[model samples]
Target: MSRPSENGLSSETLFFTATWNGDSTRCVARLAPAVEAVPVFPAYDLRAQFEIMRLAREKAGIPAPRTLWFEPDPAPLGTPFFVMERADGQVPPDVMPYTFGGWLHDASPAEQRRLQDASVGILAALHQTAFTAEELAPLGEAGLRAHVAAQRAYYAWAHGRRPIPLLERAFAWLEEHWPDEPGPDVLSWGDARIGNMMFRDFTPVAVLDWEMAAVGPRELDLSWMIFLHRFFQDITTGAGLPGLPGFMRREDVCATYRELTGYEPRDLDFYELYAALRHGIIMARVWQRRIHFGEQPMPDDPDDLVLHRATIEELLAGYEPAS
Candidate 1:
């Protein structure tokens, strides 16, 4: 898959899936200049992702993809990108929610339990592994305040594109109910859903997607794991399917995480709300992209873009979403 770069150097493109020993492998390259969408954050540091994966694999003993090389200059592939040895496994498709129909849905309840446990185990291992302050400095200071500040910047990034009343109200609720004291800082996988992980035979092969990687409380990742499953379940149930019930339940996830890490997860109610608010903002940006492409007309209700608008509204109202 090697091709000539602009400067006539050999550049390789790691296709999403390849084969080795007759088994599927993904030697992936995360290319930048991401599709012409509204920006999520101010910028993406490509080197940071490569560095984070390298450190997680070497020091934390985590199953992370091995980074090959990082080319900061975009000339090589017309955009800045880095290459890595993609670990083996299949990810539940995002476009078609996994619960809608997939190997996950057809898997026996027992087999699905194995997948859920393995994914939670990875998060526990990450939170338990200690890193020097110098190593995590790139993630910025550790605290809920720092975490919210970054999101605030993102909200500003999406300001005035289209009015999203839900996001505005969610932000206000967060400020009013800010945690009395921030939880202890640990390795927080910013986007910690199971979808971001690579699994083989229902066990995690490698933890992928570190774009939202940060230094914050363990709850940041923990809450996302719980909420994302609930998110998909919401959609599946609405469409009248069982949708992998009994998997990644809130009580089971909390108990498993506490059992594996020897630390109790706190303020999950708050964190789940945080996850919804953060996701709401990101969904707004996605809508902006739709508008840009003329794919969807301007939504009359900004909450229209948020798939879990009902769930989000429930959280803000201090009521748990229906099971």
Candidate 2:
């Protein structure tokens, strides 16, 4: 096996590529070094997240990227970094060769449907994992409430400067209709969306990006996946991807979920509303962070703004006041 490189280092290295030895053999790794200049958040603890996900994947019997090593603080690489085994495949619903553009067009309808179904199957398996109350004690009611509060605070901070009426209304609504019982918490890949999975021949080989992995309501993952599909549909339609099947329209995805878990999705409209708000908040933060970094030429597309605004409206529409 080839030895890993300990070459150049920087104060805030955001990108680096290297090869390292793993338990099995050699593997390639990429590092998204620390952003010391920017504000840090709970989810920034990538190392802790990797460990959580590593254990969750093993327990759930899911194929995921192997996390070889990680550090929480800046030290050897002048920032926190983790090495992981790279999976060979393509990110679905992406604009890459195997996804959008002419690639999806070349593929038969069945092939496209298969890929979509596989994506849903991955979520089913994730949500179906059996985790004990003792094991999930760390992520009990307090943790769930904190998570929700943090999200609300993060979005408030991001939108505080601009004060979008729709966003404020959505945030208020989310607080009002917060689930009475979010159901027994399960291991949730907080960002369980198609873009985070690798696919080969219309099948998911590995799920990636567990930075937000945590014990949460199973509906959290489901909502994230569905909302992502909606986002892709919007983007594909905007880009003129003709004949592209709606990523979340097929009932087979939901059917498979019910069959695998023996639990039909309840209050989907509520969760979908929350999902949209969550997505919009995240995106808004991304844009805000970009501005903070002096990255100009922000998205000027009115339609993009409309999509986010519409998401906020949907959240408000689904809001039911607390009794």
Candidate 3:
């Protein structure tokens, strides 16, 4: 047993590298949030994520890491665990962010462009996956509306009494401008950012993290990837660093996806705001959890709990996709 360098691991998981019978293994031993278990996932059955990865790998031919076994019995490790083959590659770090400076930062713009296009290609292929009704059932109530409602439920659970007005306002904004045609629902990789994927030679070799997988409009995943990259890039440059400005532009991303899938991405203003709102809710929860652990203080303004308060305001102001 070994622990990988602690630099870039997911905060929500405890991981260990092990030998999987014969294949080298990376075991996802537990989901340990600071305050509570993720409300979206069920306690009894972890079948949803395992099956999602299988469908992506076997049917869609995506590079999702192959999960080996699941031991739902908590007696083994004090928490239920699963083992899967460890993927080898570099992942963009969420802490400092790859946009600040690193291997990906050192890569030429051409290589970065190659990585960008290839990453979106995974989403294009992922949407093509034929999911069973059983699969969709596990992903919460059907429809995009349900997805938003799930977020609302999660916020109520996460915040307890200290409601984030910014998040609530964003939710109201969503209600006011709901898409007339949200388009057909597809398999949306809920956390569809390059940061969740492992890349080799500027291409994705292993798509990691399916915790947020869902059945929704194609734009759900598309906007998530675009908004997250922009989120990091905005933060990096705000601190006087030269973030990857040319990468992951909304127009460029939509064009690439349209070229591959033959459907123009629509209602992205709604989805991207939805994406930021979703992230704001999560970030606010993370802050409140830190207070729970005495790692941080309760802020004077509750909206301050959300790291991207200004971004949420700007998004609320309204966005017109770059021409």
TM-score of each: 0.89, 0.78, 0.91
User: Residue 182 deviation, candidate 2, in Å?
Assistant: 2.8
Evaluate model 1: give its lDDT.
0.79
Candidate 2 residue runs with Cα over 4 Å from true position? 1-33, 36-43, 93-102, 132-144, 176-181, 239-243, 293-307, 314-323
Write one digit per residue (lDDT tens) for candidate 3, span 40-98: 32232356777788788988899988887776666766655566677788888887888
Residue 202, model 3: lDDT of 93
lDDT of each: 0.79, 0.63, 0.81
Instruction: Estimate, for each residue in 1-323, the C-alpha lDDT of model 2 and write its tens digit.
Output: 24323221211223234534643443544344445444433235555556666766788767787777776566665656776666677665444422255545567778777877777777777777787666555443434566677677776665665655555666666666667766666777788876777778878888876656667667778877777777766665656774355545636667767877887776666577777877776666556556677785455542243345664554565455446
RMSD to native for every prediction? 5.6, 5.6, 3.2
Model 2, residue 199: C-alpha shift (Å): 0.9
* Residue 84, model 2, lDDT: 68
User: How big is the RMSD of model 1?
Assistant: 5.6
Q: How many clashing pairs in candidate 3?
A: 0
Best by TM-score: 3
Candidate 1 per-residue lDDT over residues 205-241, each given as its tens digit: 8787787888898889989998888888888999999
Ranking by lDDT: 3, 1, 2
For candidate 1, the per-residue lDDT at 86 reads 54
